[model samples]
Target: MIYTLERTQFFTCGLDEAWAFFTNPNNLATITPDTLNFKVLDTFDTPEIYEGMIINYHVTPLLGIRLSWQTRITEVVPRASFIDNQEKGPYTLWQHTHEFFAEDGGVRVKDTVRYAMPFGVLGTLVHKLIVKNKLREIFDYRQQTLEKILNYPAHD
Candidate 1:
């Protein structure tokens, strides 16, 4: 079964600034948790994001076991939103959508991730035992890091 996770954050920045910051692949490591050891393996030739862009990364998400993850930028809307689908990764399915909106005080950033595990019933068991909480922890760290870097107020 596929599982979903959604996170929303408000940044004290404009849509364009938020878009540029989020679209830059280099900034990923800055926001990601240190424990994950996430690294992007792409030399961005252009500053603007375009569809079909492929990003490769090495991440140690669990038990110090490093894995290669490849994702393709499937859709892009400047200053609005983008979607990335996993090409190869630990999960059986991974699709992440990032959206930006102009809110009262700043830009509202939203992320929606849909993923499924491998190994059928075993995957379900693992999800319950570990993956679910791990995902939450990852996003929680992201939110905290983003707030610090962006100088935005923290959420409860």
Candidate 2:
């Protein structure tokens, strides 16, 4: 079964500023929950995100069990939006789209994720028992962290 999750957040920042921070793959670790221990395998010196870009990372999503995930940037539109599809990951299918809009003197960032687990019926049961809540926790952490990161004086 395929599942979807969407979250939106507004920050008092310009479009360019929000675009730069969100597009940079390096910043992903900062917004992710510490318990997940998300780490990128490759170092990205440039903040420019482009189509065909591949990111490799490992994350401890549940029970301290580390899973390596690889995603490809399939679409990008500068400060507007980008879509990434999982090449290799825990999910049977994982596709996430990050979108940004300039609204009310701030940037409204939204994320839409469509994913599916493995193991057929067992996967559905597992998602009900674990994955759903875990995803919520992860996104909640991201929202709270971004609220802090995007509004502070240190934000650049």
Candidate 3:
């Protein structure tokens, strides 16, 4: 079961600020949907994410089932884009590409994910029944959360 999802968001902030927000793993726990119960267990090297860096996390996307998630930064292009691939996680293959562009008043951000799950035929069933919607919801929450964070200053 191969699944791909792409989403774009416009933010009223500069490219550098946008890139800084996304590239910083610490902020991930904030934007991620609360339903996922996402938490970063071990931190990766800070400032810039380079290839071969591992991020360890624990999430409970489903009820009471804690999942150990791990992903590696497979590619990086400074403030332009980066790709992270799942090394050990829920998916059989999960690759997410984050691209940032300077728009008129801010930055245009795009997230593209290409993934597949385990269990072959059964994975397709799971995707249709649960994973697909879960992914959509997560990204939707992300957009809203980011908008609030980027629009308001720290003191706000």
The candidates, ranked best first by TM-score, are 2, 1, 3
Candidate 1 stretches with Cα past 4 Å from truth are: 152-156
Candidate 3 residue-wise lDDT at 14: 90
Error of 3 at 94 (Å): 0.4
Worst 10 residues of 3 by lDDT: 147-156
Q: For candidate 3, write residues 100-132 as lDDT tens digits.
A: 998887889999999998998888898999999
Candidates' TM-scores?
Answer: 0.94, 0.95, 0.93
Error of 1 at 56 (Å): 0.3
Task: For residues 5-122, write the lDDT of model 2, one tens digit per residue.
Answer: 9999998878889999988999989989899989999987677779999999999988889999999999999889999999999999999999999997688999999999999999
Q: Tell me the alpha-carbon RMSD of every candidate.
A: 2.7, 2.6, 2.7
**What lDDT would candidate 1 get against the real structure?**
0.91
Better of 1 and 2 by lDDT: 2
- Model 2 CA deviation exceeding 4 Å by range: 152-156
